[model samples]
Target chain A: MKTLVIVAHPQLADSGTQQFLKTSLQNFSTVTWHVLAPDVDVAAEQALLRRHDRIIFQFPLYWYSAPALLKHWEDEVLTRNFVYGAQHELAHKELGIVVTTGDAKREFVAGGKEDYTMSELLRPYQALAHKAQMSYLPPLPIFQFAYLTDAQKQALLVTYQQYITNSDFTSFHGQELWFEGQLKAKIDQTKGTSKQQLTQILTAVQDNREQLEELRWTLSLIKDNEDE
Target chain B: MKTLVIVAHPQLADSGTQQFLKTSLQNFSTVTWHVLAPDVDVAAEQALLRRHDRIIFQFPLYWYSAPALLKHWEDEVLTRNFVYGAQHELAHKELGIVVTTGDAKREFVAGGKEDYTMSELLRPYQALAHKAQMSYLPPLPIFQFAYLTDAQKQALLVTYQQYITNSDFTSFHGQELWFEGQLKAKIDQTKGTSKQQLTQILTAVQDNREQLEELRWTLSLIKDNEDE
Candidate 1:
């Protein structure tokens, strides 16, 4: 599916985390990266939205929401007749948010200093999605990007790729199947030991899926016994 | 107390509710009305905040939060060192939100289509206030402004006046005292019959305060009795 990542930061070029995240998506030919400018072409933006199957708004959490630039873009680009009313040009398209926060993920909870979850704070976007009849995906929150280790960054890169490209990243079974399919595709293209390694990884993924199904069945049986 | 109302609506001139609200505040000499422009003066904006005891960010709710212009004002005007850190210019000042929503008040709650309370959605502003060490006042949300009856609009004018001008508008006892004080001052400035009418209203206000105090005392006694 075609993916659009709209990055809205005042100083995006200066931001290391945002730069890294942008660079990680270089390999995805289907992903289009759009950065906000002071003066935006409204028609061009609308056209971009129309083309993308999945629309991701990526920005640092400024005052618990998007920057003014993004907000302005929304107000200007998403006009009533075209985006909302009878026409509803954006219906059935997927909407996602990739928010980077300066605070730790733990701080965004009911009893924490922030005093609310990211989901609660980001409800406006979800409401927007609902209004447009679009599928609102769960937000991918990258917390304390500056403090993350190299390994954590690598893990985040993989997750970010999945979030932007993979339609069913939220489901474990779906994600495993997607990864296994990737390995299966690579097995025929690779040479020598690399092909063998790809086959081995695909076999392991299939075996793990079977084990997970068994575990789920056992848990369901236990629940049934308790119900009796 | 000097009150500053920062109005941030892109189409403020066209909005009937906002225009009426603006007209209502003409009597308050201490209340400075600042309408945000496309290009804002950062230093002058900071100076206005310095002059005002209470700062109210007034705007129509766009995407469940302040409009882009207001967000831009915050992003540009409220900066490090000036608003926070060592200098902390905004500390001890009261921060208020005056938001007008097109949706009905009932729609903004748990299990409703909106799926979140106004307070929950506006937490980002509250958190911003916390960060700046500013006292965050309860937000004044004008719901379904277009659908409000004339009588409801009149009541809203009174409440809005109190919110902007009265230092302790949120407190019942404080509001009573303020109303009583206003009547007392008006009595001095009026003709014989008008003076008499003001005196009578002041007496009623004082009597109500006494009645409220008695009710609170009786309720506390019941609680104490239950504890025993």
Candidate 2:
């Protein structure tokens, strides 16, 4: 799919995470990068958006949110008639957000100074996606890149390259339930399973469940602590 | 107290509710009205903020949230070391929000298309206020202004004036539990209420709670019906 990445960072030259991601996507002819500064013309932005199939808002999270210019772009480019009231201009198009956060994943949880989960922090964007009638993708979050060693940064860059180029991204909606159903179906597909086969499948499912539970528990604990 | 009103409508001239409020506030010598359009200089904005005791963010809700420019202002003006991190510049300042919602009050509930109450939608601002160490005031919601009759609009303007000018504004924050323990001791002497009279004084507290619950339930019901 033709992807339009709207890169919004005040100082891209100084942004290691953003620069690395942009450089990685440089070889992809299908991907168009629109470097949006605060002074970008509104008409030009709207025109650029009209030509794209999938729109990705790429930004460094400033004070737990997108920088001012990106927010300004949303206000100007997403007009009432086009994005909301008239309907269908953005319908069926995919909307994605790629954010580079300053803090570790733990700092975004309930008790952290940020006082909200990444999901909670991005609810406004989800609401915007709903209004625009676009299919919202799960955000690609690069956490604590500022603290990463050079080797760690390279590893993250590799992961990011894989993340962006992957064609069959899992949809964000009801993800857990969908994955669970898939796992059950896979288990059922094995007809006349031996004890060994059953044990293997069960082990994989148990491992997946354990990982999911750990993530869920950590998030819940953070949320509970935040409430206090 | 000096009140700084940051009017954050992309097209303030065309906005019915915002225009009316702006016109009504023209005679108030104590109120410093800052019209924050897309073109506002970041440095000038910060300088203006430093002079005010009370800061009010005025906007029309777009896509169940504040207009993007308001978010832009938050990102740009509420900087690190000033709003947070360093000794707080906004610690003693009172922050308020005045929102003109296109959706009816009934349409902002649990099951509605909006799927959130105004309070829930406004959590980010509250979190920002908490971080900034500012006294967060209850939002002044001008609901269904498009449907209001001329007489009703006039009455609303009067209420708006009272809300902005009232000397006993501390009472509004006093009713909020988040502020109760923190601010009650300091203001209790002024309230002439003994410790024994706290229960009797909490009648207003109970009333505010009931109203908030009613609003939440009504919004949810409206949203549920809208989808059908």
Candidate 3:
């Protein structure tokens, strides 16, 4: 699926998180990155949005929200008759937010220092998506980016790519399926033992995914029976 | 208390609600109204915020959020050493939002057309207030301005004034006190049965306020006892 990443950091050149994400996302040929600048052409931005299947609003959280330019882009680009209203252009398309924060992830909980969950604070975007008749994806929140180790950063890069490209990637089961598919595609090009190991790993992942799905179904049945 | 209202509507000139609010708020000598313009001076805006005892961010809700210029104001004016950081300048000051919406008030309830309460959707501003150590006042949501009757518009004008000026206007007792005070001031200027009628109305309002407070206290006591 074609994905669009609209980056909206005022000081993108100076931000380490923006730099990391930019470099990480550059490998995907189906992904297009648009930076929010002062002289952005509204028509071109709307056209770009129409062309993409999944649109990710990537920004650093400023005062528990996105920076100014993103808001500006929303105001200018998402016009009434064009993007919203009776004849909607962005219907069924996915809208996601990838936010980086200076504070720790633990700080974004009910009784934490922030006093509200990230989901609660980011409800406006969800509401916006609802209004536009788009599918609202769960936001990807990266906290304390400056303190992330090399391994953690590399893992985040892979996760970020999955967030953009993977269609059914809202669950661990879906992620495992993607990983298994990736291994299967490469297994044909490998040697005897390597191919065998890859096949074994894929089988293990599939078994784990089935177990998770079964457990989830059992839990839902229990909940339903209790309600009845 | 001196109030500083920072108005941030992109098309303020065309907005009827904004115009009504502007005209209504003009009568208050202690209130200063500042409209956000394109080339806003950062230092001046910060200084303005510092001078006021109560700060109200007034705007029409654009895409379930504030207009872009308000976000720009926050980004530029609220600096590290000034608005936030160790020596935060905005601490203990009242930060209120006076937002106008195109949707109906009933639409902003659980299971309603909007599918979320106004308080839930406007959590970002609350979080911003928490981060700045400012007193987060309950937001005033004026909905469906175009559909409001003349009397409704007049009531909203009085409510808008109270939101900006009254320190404890959220409670019924505070509103009754304000109404009583206003009536008391006008009593000496009148004579005969007109004065008596006003006196009777004030007494009735005060009595209702007292009864409401007592009922609230009783309900809390019952809840506390049940918890015990």
Candidate 4:
């Protein structure tokens, strides 16, 4: 599937984790990286979105949420007739988020300083996904990136690379596995795990991974193709 | 104090309750109603915000949260160094929300379709307020605006007028009273209530109705002055 990664960091050039992830996607040929600002031309954005099957919003968690420009993009780009109401254009697209958090994951819970789970904090986006009729993937969270040891950061970078490129739902090595487990449990319970069903599930997962990798590769080629 | 109302309605002209509230504010002299949108210029927005002591975000609740644009404004206007970090511009300013909900207040709870309280859904804003060192008031939620009788809406208009003008904090009536009661209980227990304090509380409650009316008048005048 074609993927559009909308990088929404206010100062992406200064970002280590986001910069690293953006650089790593250079090897992939299917993903289309769109570094968006609030002032992006609407027609231009629509064209970029039309080429992608999945739209991934990547940002650093600011005040427990996304930066303002991304919010502006959603407001302006995801217009009424296009994103909601009866004839929404974004109905077929898949929506996901890749966020780097300054705080640890444990700090985003009931008794924690943040006092809300990441899921609960990000529920607004989930609600938006539901309204837009898009399949919402669980967020890819990189917690405490600033404090990570060099080795830990390297490990995180590798995991993040694997996550963005891997389409196989079952083999996702990053934090996305938490969401995958939730999805697996639901599917397993609903379908009743017969041997044939299990095989199909595994195959679908692998296929999804390959599609994701292709998307990454495609995105890297967009700039080169435009130059030519 | 000059109060700024940042109104965020996808279609403000089409909304009945919101339109009425917007109309009522015309009677006040100290209120600045800022109808926010993507088209609004950034420098102009910053200037408007700098002029106001109290910033109130008014919006119809969408899927148990603010619309995308409102979130965008929060992200954009409330910047790191300005709103937080070393230099705090909005420090000491009062931040409030005036939200209109389609569902009843009871429906935003543990067993409801939302499975979360309005307070929980709005935690991100509250967190923003805390981080920015602004006094975060409990949101003024107009539950089931469509279901309200004309008389109820009229009364609400009056109460909302008081809320926006920062007149008597306790005069406006709604389920917010219950929320305030809960807050009061916490406050009462912490500081033993002296007779003078009790008198002050009683006077504040008694003055609410008139204070709200006076506030509306004050805000309307402010709007008129700005228009000229």
Candidate 5:
């Protein structure tokens, strides 16, 4: 599915999180990065939205909501006729959010510093999705991007890519396939001794994926037998 | 209490509700209508906020949230330190909202056309109030202003004014006192037969107030006797 990442930040040039996300999605052929601005051509933006299957509203959370630029974009591009009118232009499409927060992720919970879940805080978008008849995905919240270790950053990059590309990202099996594709792509670009090591890793990943699939099939078969 | 109404509309001049509200509060010297712009002076805004006992965010609902201009003002004006830092600047101050929607009021409920309550859609503001240690008053939603009957319009005017001025607006006792005060003011400004009519109405209102107070006192006395 084609994904459109509409990023809105007042100081887009200075945000490290936006930079990291931009760099992470460089290899994604089916993804489009759309930066929101003060001036919006509503018709063009609406056309762009129609072209994409999944739309991602990516932003740094300010006051527990997106930056005003995104809101501005929404106000301009999401006219009533286009959103909930009789034609239902955006119906059955998917809506996702990638929110980056300066605060720790752990603090966004009951009795924590924020005293609210991320889900509760991001209800406006869900309400919009509901109104537009779009499928709302669980938000991908990246908290304390500056504090994340290298390993965590790597994991974030993978997850972010999958959020854009993989339809079954919530499952481990889908993630395994995503990782395998990345490994295969890496192997294609590599040569000599390092390529051999990468191929072996790819083979092991494939083995794991096949075993999981087989187990799932066997479990379904057992359930069927029980029903009989 | 001094009320600061920070209004944010992309085209404030065109909004009928803003005009109505502005006309309604003509004689209210304690209420200040501060229109938000793209450029914000954070220190000045915070100082203004500090001066007011109550701060109101007045805007038309854009996609179930405030217009982008309001969010822009919020992002610029409400700095982290000024709101929730060591000083606790806005603590105990009242934060109220004046949200105008073109849709029917009854449509903003569970299973209604809007499918979500106004309270649910406006949680972001409440969350901000919580973070600042401010008291969040119930939002005043003005629905379908164009379609309101003349009587409804008058009621809306009174409610909008009371929301800004009256401390106990949710209680019938509070409304009775408010109407009494309003009637007295009208009586003072009038002459001849009209003044006499207003005075009679005021007297009748006062009598009702006394009766309610007497009933409340008797109920409390009965409770005390029960305790004895």
Candidate 6:
């Protein structure tokens, strides 16, 4: 599915987290990066939104919401007639949020310092998705990006890539397929022994995925037999 | 307490509900109506916020949240340093929301068309209040102002007045005291038989209040004895 990542940050140039995310998506032609401007062109935005199957509002959390720029775009572009009106151009599309926060994830709980979960903080967007008849994706929260180690950052990159491009991001089998596809593409460009090692890794991934699928099928049959 | 009603409507003059609310607060010298401009003066706005004991963000609900203008004001005016820095000016102050929606209040529920409660939808503001160390008041949602009958409007006027002016806005005793104070003032301004009738009504109100207070005292004594 085609994805639109609508970046809404005032200091876009200054944000290292945004820059890292932008660079990671460079290889995927399926992903389109649309950085929001303060001045909104309602028709153009609506058209862009219409073109994409998955619409992601990516921004650093400001006062537990999107920066005003994105809110302005929503206010101006997602007009009543264009959203939930009889036409309902955005119906059945996916609405996803990618929020970056300076606070640690643990601090966003009932008794935590923030005193609310990311889920609670993001209800407005869920409500928005409900009103427009769009499927709301679970939010991808990148918490304390600056504090993450190199290994953690690498993991985050992979998760972010899947969040943006993978249609079945929630499924483990789909993730394996996505990883396999990426490795296969990388192996194609490589020459020599490294390519052979990459191919070995790809084979293992494919073998594991097949075995898992077989196990899943057998498990489903067993469950059905038990029900009978 | 001094209350600043920060009106944040893109089309303020056009809203009959807003106009009605504005008229209701015309007599209260303690209430200040500060309509937000698109161009927010951060320093000046912060100063205004500092001056008020109660800061209210009043607007029509857009996309199940406050309008973009109010969100914009929040993004800019409420600076990190000013709000939560060394000296937190907003602490112990009250943060109030006066949201107007075109939808019926019933529609904002789990099984309703909207599929979320107003409290769930307005959590962003509550989070903001938490961050600012402000006391978050229960929101005053004015749903479908155009559909309200004359008596409903009058009742709304009284409630709105209490929301802005009455210190004990949440308690029945506070409401009684507020009404008594208003009636006594009205009685002093009247003349002749009307004055006598108004004085009688005020006396009845005063007597009822005393009786209630005595009853409360007796009930508390009974509870204390039961505890012993």
Across the candidates, what are chain A's individual TM-scores? Answer: 0.88, 0.70, 0.82, 0.71, 0.93, 0.96
Name the regions of candidate 5 deviating beyond 4 angstroms. A224-228, B223-228
As for candidate 2, its clashing pairs are: B109-B219, B109-B220, B112-B223
Which one wins by lDDT: 1 or 3? 1
Rank order by TM-score, top first?
Answer: 6, 5, 1, 3, 2, 4
Model number with the top DockQ: 6
Error of 4 at A79 (Å): 3.2
lDDT of 5 by residue, B2-47 (tens): 9999998899899888999999998888898899888888889989
In terms of lDDT, the poorest run of 10 residues in model 6 chain A is A83-92
Write the residue-wise lDDT of candidate 1 on A131-220 in tens digits: 788999999999999999999999999899899988889998878876776677678789998888888888888998999989999999
lDDT of 5 by residue, A85-172 (tens): 7568899999999999988878888788887889888888988998899999999999999999999999999889999888889999
Off by over 4 Å in 2: A39-47, A171-228, B26-29, B37-47, B63-72, B167-228
Q: What is the TM-score of chain B in candidate 3?
A: 0.80
lDDT per model vs. reference: 0.88, 0.74, 0.87, 0.75, 0.91, 0.93
Worst 10 residues of 2 chain A by lDDT: A171-180
lDDT by residue for model 3 over B1-228, one digit each (tens)? 889999999898999988888888775678999999977798788888888989999999887889889998888888878866767888999999999988999989877778788899889999888878899999999999999999999999889878987777998778778777667867867889998998888889778888988999999999999999
Stretches off by above 4 angstroms in model 3 are A180-228, B180-228
RMSD each, Å:
2.8, 14.7, 5.2, 16.9, 2.2, 1.4
Per-model TM-score, in order, reads 0.90, 0.69, 0.84, 0.63, 0.93, 0.97
Best by TM-score: 6
Q: How many backbone clashes does candidate 3 have?
A: 0
What value of lDDT does candidate 2 attain over all alpha carbons? 0.74
lDDT of 4 by residue, A79-187 (tens): 6676765577778788888989878888887777666778777877776776677888778888887788989877776666555655544344443543444346545
Model 3: which docking level applies? medium
Better of 5 and 6 by lDDT: 6
Compared with the true structure, what per-residue lDDT tens digits does model 2 show for residues A154-225? 877655654454444463333444344445655675566564586576678668777887898899999999
Two-way DockQ contest, 3 vs 4, winner? 3
Instruction: For model 1, state the Cα shift of residue B39 in Å.
Output: 1.9
Q: B191-225, model 1: which lDDT tens digit per residue?
A: 88877877888888789899999999999999999
Which residue pairs of candidate 1 clash?
none
Clashing pairs in 5: none
